[model samples]
Target: MLNRVILIGRLTRDPELRYTPTGVAVTQFTLAVDRPFTNQQNEREADFINIVTWRQLAETCANYLRKGRLTAVEGRIQVRNYENNEGRKVYVTEVVADNVRFLESANREPASGGGMREEAPQSRYGNQRSQQQDPFSDDGKPIDISDDDLPF
Candidate 1:
């Protein structure tokens, strides 16, 4: 049972942050993804998708993400239904994001005032060391490694 979805698109609008009754942070936003093929008029079309993030990730997204910023979202497709005020059953489909990445650099600011976070996200290796202190830094020089260091 595998349920996963990955999408790369520009945000249609700024993220809307909200809190639940338990005080947990939640954010919702819409992503405008361009379709691969063009329409009859040869004009490209885009699909608007709803994205939902929870917990600390939600707050992070709310603070850093802005409208028209390119982003990548990885999550599962969720479909739920509820009765509207008219008593008609309504179904909603959205992505419950587990990971959200800002594809564009913070230096590139849109017409809107808000911008992304200044600091880059750390690598999976945990703490990020300065480039000058990195032993594996690529300085256009060949790296010296012994055969013993090569697992192959």
Candidate 2:
């Protein structure tokens, strides 16, 4: 009875936003997910998955997300069967997103030399800033932790 899916991947293209006749916002996009293992040729394989979002989330995704942006989506898989014009039956499967998390942080530093800078993280709902601070020191030093103090 469980039909849940969690995916973290890069977008294949910009999200397309539209509205239903009742004025509800809807967005559709494709995500490119890399396979866990590489092929014999040493190239990693990828799967392009179709995703759909509804309401406010859909609007937010369409407005802020772009091609190649990394994102995490939580949703359920949906499968449907249809008959084509050639009288052939086809099966379609896609993810219907319930909630989406923008994985890339918005506080990225500018790129050196003339390359594209890394994107900062953005919230889908509003511009509320994050309060969580990094555990590491500003000078790239790690926080001291002793094995004897481990909770696990």
Candidate 3:
């Protein structure tokens, strides 16, 4: 009776935003998540997952998210089938994201795009506090955490 999925990964490309006939916003993108274990060739593998977002969230993601940006997606897995033009049934599996969190700073150069970067939207999924340093930064600097910061 429950269907939920949570994934943390980098975006494979910029989100494509579109509007439906009813004027509702929709976005589609792919996320590349790494596997926990290496393959027999000792190489790490990844799974490319398709993500879809709707309405305001879709607009926000398309405007702020870019290729190679680390992000967190929370949603449900969906599988639907439809007949193709060739008279074959095509089954598609994708995640319908309800929430998305940006995991990187906006100051860094994007993986592909080159243009003026606007400030991200202010929301739970967007930047919350601008002045506070992110403890999970991937800058290779040692984090300074006190005992009180630990849960256990």
- The CA lDDT of each predicted structure is 0.81, 0.80, 0.83
Error of 2 at 102 (Å): 0.9
Per candidate, the number of residue pairs that clash is 0, 5, 0
**Ranking, lDDT, top scorer first:** 3, 1, 2
| Model 1: residues with Cα > 4 Å off, grouped in runs | 109-119, 122-152
- True-structure lDDT of candidate 2: 0.80
lDDT of 3 by residue, 2-100 (tens): 999999888999999999999999999999999999999999999999999999899889878889887888999999999999999999999999988
Model 3 residue 2 CA deviation in Å: 1.1
Using alpha carbons, what is the TM-score of model 3?
Answer: 0.73
TM-score, structure 1 vs. true: 0.73
Q: List the residue pairs that clash in candidate 3.
A: none
**What tens digits encode model 2's per-residue C-alpha lDDT throughout 1-152?**
99999888889999999999999999999999899999999999999999999998898889777888777888999999999999999999999999787765433322244222223444457444468785454666666779988999
The superposed Cα distance between candidate 3 and the true structure at residue 85, in angstroms, equals: 1.4
lDDT of 2 at 21: 98
